[model samples]
Target: MTGPLDIHTARRRYITVCVLFWLPLGLSIAPLILLFTERGMALAAIAGFFAAHSLTASALELPTGGLSDVLGRRAVLAAAGLLNLVALTLVGLGSAPWLLGLGMALMGAGRALSSGPAEAWYVDTVQEHSGLDAELRTGLARGSSATSAALATGTLLGGALPWLLGLGPDLGALVSEATSELVLPLSVPILLGAAVEIAFVAYVLTALRERPRPAATLRDVLRGIPATIVGGLRLGGRDALVRRVFLSAGATGSALAAVELLTPGRAAALTGASESGAVLFAALACAGFVCAGIGSHLAPLTARLANSGERAVMVSLGASASGLLLLGATAAFAGVASLVLATIGYGLIYLGLGAAGPSENDLLHRRVSRSGRATALSVQSLAQQLVGALTGLIIGVLPSGPAPWLLGGSMLLAGTFLWIRRSGPASPTEAATPQPHTASSSPSAVGSGPLQQHADQ
Candidate 1:
């Protein structure tokens, strides 16, 4: 058997996987909506595409977690990468809205499949080797930073590529003609994303290996998955901390959905052309990712300053809500100043979220056992996706401009209060070490807790 994994090795692998997983998404983010419009899709049709992706992802989140838990992380991740490859290809090449929707569905499935496995694997490996109290915040922060950095790099390059191609030799036009307009200049980034998915698959296959579990038939997985899903669901109801985390995740999701749904159109209006807007949005996205990277890099320091993860999250939420409020307030103004304010507000929101995520996850890992790690993460992701779906619907009906941002800001402000007080004092073990023993585990970790009882039943 291989030797136990070291923390440094595990952390390095974790950050590497994070970069690989997120880079393709960053590459495609600049052009996805613009591409649909380029192909003659309407506002409602674009909304439907996003809704379809969200619904598919949300529906599969729990099941995919169970699948990862039962089947091991590497397999599920590789499967996701392969699926992403197909999805990106279709999206890059297809013009019909139905075809695009089909591609988006597959992409959502890939997202669901890939969601928790890498981080789960890292947490599991770390806890196994370093014990449950291992200092997770720094490593998690670094991973988050790496992800943001990848996105920033990808966005800048992807955004510039189309503009660059059109300028030099009119290469985009030649390519568009050659492919019968299936691969427009805007489509190049997504097609490039497909190439990166291939790399993701290869990396996962080679870099990740699970400790051997007892050999079991396919029957074992089939039976265990539903049970795991049930256990994951019970966590929110039974544990105060878990419930709060779910609530925080949902609120953040709503805020994000509003920004993403509204901001691109506003940007399109600002630039006065669909094509120019795509480029502008890409640059803005790059800046936002840079801000997020800075926030992630500062998370450990934030936790120290706040004196606890809970306070850190509260502070982060407040910052995000403040930014959203600013965004809402500036919506009516027109000109360079308003655009600059909007961009700053958008960057701040991302920055706060990036800072909050690692601290929040650090607490989550403290609460969960290795066995349920992926499932717990999945539950968190499910809350985000479900709330995001609802937020999209709400935004669809709302009047354009500040209303959606105001509503989202209000929700985020409410979430900030969830962590104002602790459920109880941290036990001696929890207080003393980064890793907590079972007796001193977060409220969610109580063995005889209601969630455990529900699991038994």
Candidate 2:
């Protein structure tokens, strides 16, 4: 990592990191619920497991982000990978309720630690090589695309592995017998994911080079993080554009929560059995990831087409909202047409979010300086995660059917509207946003007179 790399090399490394980290999560998705059930866990217990994951991630988001800022990207990322390695292995092998729960909480901690470090590292590297006005959209978008592609590929493979093993003399049964029922067919994906985590950690340690931060004592590291955290917290309040971006992140979260909660049951209903429903859902999930990858790949073009990052976000989010609305509008129907529309709606949800993410982040990166970059990204993630959790709760309590879809769509629409008024001084003719003053402090120091002028303009 000490060796100098061109921006192309940096971006390629970043994309690879994205794929390596995200693919494992994707692999676990297809078999996770079934695995829990196979272990004799009820719906409530399964929900508790997920709640543990979310709660742990939510609680650690800021601290972990600050950890990255205070420590360095490579170390934090490697730690995250190691945590995920242990977490996935434990989840794969452990049968007891507490073991599984602890595994999930560890997984969440891994997730929180992994969130923004790689991207932050890339951004930092680009600035070092290309100066202050480095082009970040392409790298960010490519990273998003790589992540989506990994998920899609992993979904297909993970979903197929168990079935493939089940056929031809039932290798899965043989494995179960050999392992004394400790490792089921469904557990293979997770075990494979754990192996991948090892690779992810190794790659991150070697590929994501960073200039080492000054070696600080534990107390100094501790003190610096809070100051950075406080600065990141104050960031959105001071910068109007940053605030809009965070709000938009929340809206995206709400929409995503609705989609994730509603889609599985809806698929189950359509297929008339949980097993078939799962297959259909896996296929749909894969397709959604593909669509998301395509959207991320096209994000730069989307910005150009819409004229500005602001407009692109609006258009992308609006498209997503419309998709949700379509789902809501067709909720009462029962036909192939309804199914097709629902499928399209699902794809659009991922696609729009994919496209919107890069554009919104492009706007965000311009305003925040180097110091609090990861912290800012973590805050953005926190906003999304916390809001998504709340949204899930709200959707759960609400009566089923179009109500959930409508709630999400309405919230996304409101977020879209935030961009319509153009709170920042983005030009109608240009796609890139104006950069902020690079004051060498945290984000609280980032938005002073210059950023105020940006809002006014």
Candidate 3:
């Protein structure tokens, strides 16, 4: 963590960080809403809880990304882990609504803090040894695969733990009694997530080694962060390729929003009962993550087959859009064929998104130098989150049919078309050390962020 590492060492550490950082979040996913319901929160309150988390993360994304650029990746990541630790503990143990809400906000803050630093650290490490010529797709792909694997594994474990405990002499009751009704069975996964967060912090501190930035005063950070943010905002305008990446992220967010919004009720309808539907949805969710992991693992081959990173993004996203269209086309049907097609479409959606991610990021990395890497990533994240939220709002009001699915697919398809031609940089890395534009050429765009560690982002 303190010295220069070889590329192999760096890749290994990057993969480890991905797994450790994501596993705890995965653990909480299956049971978080369930835990809230167990604690007497109504659907409205639970929705409010999530909104608080989303808003907090969104608001903090750009600033936190700047913080990482100004501070160091390791420091910001460690701080994120610490915040998650406290957040998880509060969420698991607190009975009061306000305490739970505060916990969620803190978790959002932690998410914002952690977003881009880990990957930025990996890119920096590789670039240190190999300079601008490093083959980053492999590392990024593997890290992404590890993340999906951790999520799939954690989802299974989180969902099963409570049931397993219940089957063995009422262990859950005993724990609740011991804690005076505070530690419910549903709380177990979140508490375990808190424990895992400890490991995440330790690993981040010990494994994600980065060359330190120069020590600076508070004044420097205040000045540096805003200036860095401004420069990052200009990144998209100055670099057309990076703009494509940002817009593509928004398209992805839109498509994902549609699927997430529609999938649950579809599952329930298929199963004919909410309980069975919940079980089926969980299974499908786990399967989707596995498919995404497989796609990530195959990203290198995907790039090779498509002949270029840009082409690979086009192919991958096109496939994803096609899947959305399939869903939309079959929305009015109900039969074995419909079910089979729907399942295939679901798998394709995740797989294509997963495959496209590494290639897209490889392009982004090549365009930006170290000075504003994390901030660039934050800008991408913000676009995705903001656009996805907007898409979700629109989807919410639409009548149940293929319209929503078509709308999402069309948006993604439009984004895919943006890659039909090169984005007009004579050289891809022309902006590797980019600067903000002068007054004569002023141009704008990014907001304040997660397709991050979760599919839900």
Candidate 4:
């Protein structure tokens, strides 16, 4: 009999869950910023909140990821959704810094708990139906598209809602009404998000079925951690291609984070617009999301056109670097035309990056063993976070106008380096063909042909 965890069903569920999860996150950003401003919080304090949350989340990621290996993906993800519901609720209600910090920490924990497991679940489920190669690109594309759509919708609503509510207030009552309006509109998504998450948890409980975990002691689980970490590191270290992929991913992530941190300020300066300029920039950001969503949906075609996964990634990175360069130029020159061109460039680059995401992820999965997958992924995640944090700190301390130029230049250099290092000419083993999928076959029966062929040579 065909398994319940078919790729088509799983993909739909994955997209649904992503939309629900991201809507709240998207909505929360504006409120979080407003709250920070309202309280007269320092940049350092805001940075501290993010840093503390990331540090704690990083600590838990590995352990919980391992737990997913032992306990199963569905259980872990359901728990994560519930945790996010609580955390988002707290964030909406919080007025004090300590309370906000607590909420942020909880949010981080929820993110940590959810991050690797959902992907793992998708891959595992899809592989059961269609095998890895068939599902990998399409699955990632669908998920990315869903996430981008969620962000665009949430941001548009978040940016517009305050103004909509602020319109009706009488002159004497306007200030109080506006403040109250601000809180509710921003908080609405989070409340709705909680309900969506609960629904997702229920869906997962009913829909997802996987192989039961093998009997193991708590000691057994703990003992696997060291070996798992060592195995992941060894696999990446020994393989030049894998090492380059990690480096490229880390660099790209760092560059993207730097852009996100600096872009709004740059846009405001270039346009000579006040804080209200943020709304326009926010709209631009939503446009970028739409671009990314479209690009991800068309990733398969892009990958084919590029000839190889490595080349696709290079194209993506190169586009992003170019976009950043344009952004820097626009900021320096300060013209409306330049601003429009820069936004267009940035959106296109984001699209390319989204296109490359799935292929890169598939390459990682192909190279690593199932037992070490989450650990390997966690290492990559940690590297990206570390690099992003460092980039943010450096930008903050230096405070140079040319910082965007430097960051863009660095991304270009990194992408060029990876392109040069491309695992030249796949061996006969490396070029092994993927197997076709059929609905009647079990996952294990579907295809070991390609992987086995690759391993043999």
Q: Which has the greatest TM-score?
A: 3
Candidate 1's C-alpha lDDT?
A: 0.78
Kindly report which residue stretches of model 2 are placed more than 4 angstroms away from their true locations once superposed. Answer: 1-4, 425-457
lDDT of 4 by residue, 332-383 (tens): 5655687688776677667766776666776666654444455556666666
Q: Would you estimate the TM-scores of all the predictions? A: 0.89, 0.93, 0.94, 0.84
Residue-level lDDT tens digits of model 3 in 1-457: 4667889999999999888888888888888888999899999989998999999999998988888887888999999999999999999999899999999999999989988998989998998888777899999999989999999988998899888889959999899999998999989988999999999999888777778666767766777787767867777776577778888988988998888888888889888998888888888888888988988888899999988988988998898898889999889899999989988888898898888889898888877767678888888888888999999999999999899999899998998898889654344344454454232121111221111222332
Using lDDT as the measure, the top candidate is: 3
Which residues of candidate 4, in runs, are more than 4 Å off? 1-4, 39-44, 132-135, 167-185, 271-274, 424-457
Question: Which model, 1 or 2, shows the larger TM-score?
Answer: 2
Candidate 2: residue pairs that collide: none
For model 1, name the residue pairs that clash: 133-434, 133-435
The candidates, ranked best first by TM-score, are 3, 2, 1, 4
Residue 28 error for model 2, in Å? 0.3
Angstrom error at residue 410, model 1: 0.7
lDDT comparing candidate 2 with the true structure: 0.82
lDDT-wise, the better of 3 and 4 is: 3
